[model samples]
Target: MRILIIHQYLWSHYKGKIYSELQKIVNTHKNDELLVLQTSLNEITRANLGPVDRSIHQYNYQVLVDDYYENIPNTTRAKKMLYWVRKFKPDVVNISGYYEPAMNTVLFYCRLVGIKVIISVDSTEEDKPNIWWKEAIKRFVVNRAQGFFCYGSKAAEYMLKFGAKPHQILLENNAVDNQKIASIYKEAYQTRETEKAKYGLRPFNFIYTGRLMAIKNVANLLIAFAKLKPQNWGLVILGDGAEGENLRKYVADEQLEGVTFIEGQAWYNVPKFMALGDVFVLPSYSEPWGLVVNEAMVGGMPVIVSNKCGSSHDLVKNGENGYTFNPYDTDELAAIMKKFVDDPDLIKSFGAVSQSIIKKYSPEQVAQEMYDGFKKVMYEHK
Candidate 1:
């Protein structure tokens, strides 16, 4: 099988990991070939998420465009994507998204060439408002594809509403480099005290490592943390964004104690800072799939994820691995945070469950699932 994957960027660390796993799958199959084409150098989405390490690395198969990441005004993108598709003549094409004009053009080309397409979706109904035109467009385009790949069942469910069949839906479940992230956190855990002291973190800290934007609900987290008034525990907010100063100001005006803000580091260096915390929390009001939760789980730290996150459906086992709460309710968020602080023993137990639950969501597993879907789609489409 000749497989070609179209993705928005190569700069993302987690996506890079997924590519590596896919390469391994190709290597295992004697006649299989895999190639990935990256549309942009870097996109605004990544640029806003703080510092990123854009250093390139060797992969078995990858092609990157010279142009930087921008959605509009890329007049040549359709021509370039069609050129590659014709040259590669892949048996299976997996496009990473549905909304990109470039991808839409490529999908049409694939139809003309008789190549099976597997559309990837990372959205749930909650991610955006339902629009009739968009739904009609998706229903038309999605039905043309032979298979669908997504972050989890929520995304698959969304595809079902778009007229995709149950058998056509494949889970490439969002994942990270479990072993690598776990190893980094393990090494950091040994000297967590020194690390925490260096960052002025408390002995027991709850960490949130993403942009400080409004949709992320960082302000709600602050409100919840403040409600815990005068506790020995601390809250570390990592990453910088438009709401950075506003969040800092809110923390100050509320006189919230032991709340420290660390500017975001590169994806690889996140574990170094994350190891200083005993628990991880993501309070996003809306999230398709939170990959950070997977990182936290692999690092052997329990998570407090908002129920709004898609990963909570798979990675979190309410009261087992971590707790899931309503992001809208500050009181509910505070109660979960207090549980972690009041009983430190739950950290170790819950952390163990986190590691266990995360093992099944590894990049290798996703690669295998993707390969299976490819075979199934090819056979059915034939």
Candidate 2:
């Protein structure tokens, strides 16, 4: 069997890890082959994370464009994609998104050629406002695909709303490199005290790692943090974006102390900073899938994510692993944050549950599921 995966960019270390594992699995099969076609090296919004590190992306892959993905012309992308699709003649083609006009072309071509198409779905219903025409168009595009690889339960549900059958749902566990992150966290955990001292972080901290955009609800996180009475806890906001200066000013104006802002680091290096905090929080009004929550869970840290995040549906076990609150409610968010401040023991207890729950979403596990999905699609198509 020959499987071709068309991904948007090579910057996602999590996808790289999944592809690497899938390649190994395919290699074990006598005549199985896998090829990944990346659209670009990175996206413009993530240029600050630096170029793609080849060391982390060790798999059979090709980049169609060396420039940022947003800058790539639709014609060029479609032409290149068709060129590769025709040359490789894959038994199955898995596309990362259907919203791209180029992908729509490829989907039609693959369908005409009798090649099974699998779509990778990450968009949840809550991520954006729904429009009648847009949803109708999406249904048209979604119905053309033979199978789907969903990010989580929410994503699978979204696909169902667009006409994808339950049996057609192939893989749903979207994940990061659990072993890699666990290793990094273990190393960081050893010198946790020393690292905190180096950065002057509080004994206990609630960390938010992502772009400081309005949709991320960073301002709301700050407001919630401000509500916390003076304690040994602090709010560590990592990553930089347009809202950085304004957020910093808000902190100054409110006289909010113990709030440290660190510029975003490379994807791999994010786990190292995760060591500085005891709890992880993501207050995003709109998030398709919060992979950072996976990173945090793998690092054995309790997570307080917004209910709006896709990951919260599958990963967060309500009071067991951590809590999920509405992003728009500052009081609810603050109340959850105060739980950690009022009782630090919840951090370790909840974090342990998080680690156990995350084991099901490891890269290796997801890769096997993807491989199984490929075989199932091929068999049904035959």
Candidate 3:
């Protein structure tokens, strides 16, 4: 089978891991070919995260239009996609996002050529504002897809609203390099205190690693942390965005103690910071799938995820791996934070559960699911 995948960027480390694994799986099958089309070199919005390692073409089956800007969609995208489609003549085409005009064009062309179409869905209803015309167009486009793949149950549920049958939706949940990250975290865990001393971090650190955006509800996290006011516990906020300075100001104005702000670094260096923390918290008001939760779990840190996050449905088991709280409830978040401080033993126990649960979510497993989805679309479906 010749499969073509169209994605926005290969800049993400998590995406790199999944795609690399997929390529490995494809190599094992006789005459199976996989080609990934990267539309953009890097994202404009996340430029602060530093330069993307363009040397990520570990697979020989990728085509990157380094000149294109993914944020801006126009007729040129249709031309570019059709160009690749004609050249590749793939048996199946997997599109990255539903909203992109380029992906929609590829979907249309694939239908014309009797090529099976698969869409990678991550947008839950909470991720986007509900607009009738938007939903109508989305429904129309989604109904045309023969196969649906997504991050979790919530994402699969979102597909149902867009006209996909339950069987047509396959849960290709997000993953990180669990084995690699776990190894790195083990090293970091051994020397955690020495590292914490260098950075002036507390003995017990609760980490949040994402953009400092309003949607992330980080201000509420700060409020929750302030409520605890534990002398030995600290909150580490990693990543920078429009909300960075505002968050710094709030931390200063409130005189919040033991809240540390670290500038965002490259994807490879993230585990270094994750290793210094005892627990991870993602209190986003709206999130499709928080990959950081997957990373933290692989690193053996208990997570406090928002119910609003799509990953929480799968990655978090209340009081097992970690707790899931309402992002809107500051007091609830504070109470969960207090649990880690009050009982340090919970960190090791909860983190163990996190490690156990995270093992099921991996790039190899996602590739197998995706391959099965493609085969289903090709030969099984009537």
Clashing pairs in 2: none
Candidate 2: segments with Cα more than 4 A from true spot: none
Q: Across residues 1-382, which tens digit of lDDT does each residue of candidate 3 receive? A: 8988887876766777777888888899988998888777677766767677755456644535565375546586677778888998989889987888878988988888899999999889888679999999999999889989898888998899887998898665778877777777777778878888988998889999989889999999999999999998999999988899999999999989899999897776788889888999999999999988998999878999999999999889998889999998999999999988999999989989998999889887887888888888877774
Please, what are the lDDT tens digits per residue for candidate 1 over residues 1-382?
9998888776777777777777887788899888888777677756744443444233454445655567535457777778889888999999977887889888888989799899989988778787999989878998888899889878888899989988888774888888889888888889888877887877788999998788999999989988887467899999988899999998788777899999977787889888988899999989999999999999889999998888888788989989999999999999999988889999999999999989899888887888888889888668
TM-score for all predictions? 0.95, 0.98, 0.96
lDDT of 2: 0.92
Model number with the top lDDT? 2
Off by over 4 Å in 3: 54-56, 71-73
Poorest stretch of ten by lDDT in candidate 1: 49-58
Clashing pairs in 3: none
lDDT of 2 by residue, 220-297 (tens): 999999998547998899999999999999999989999999889888788999999999999999999999999999
Q: Pick by TM-score: which candidate is best?
A: 2
Which rank order by TM-score, best down to worst?
Answer: 2, 3, 1
Clash totals for all models, in order? 0, 0, 0
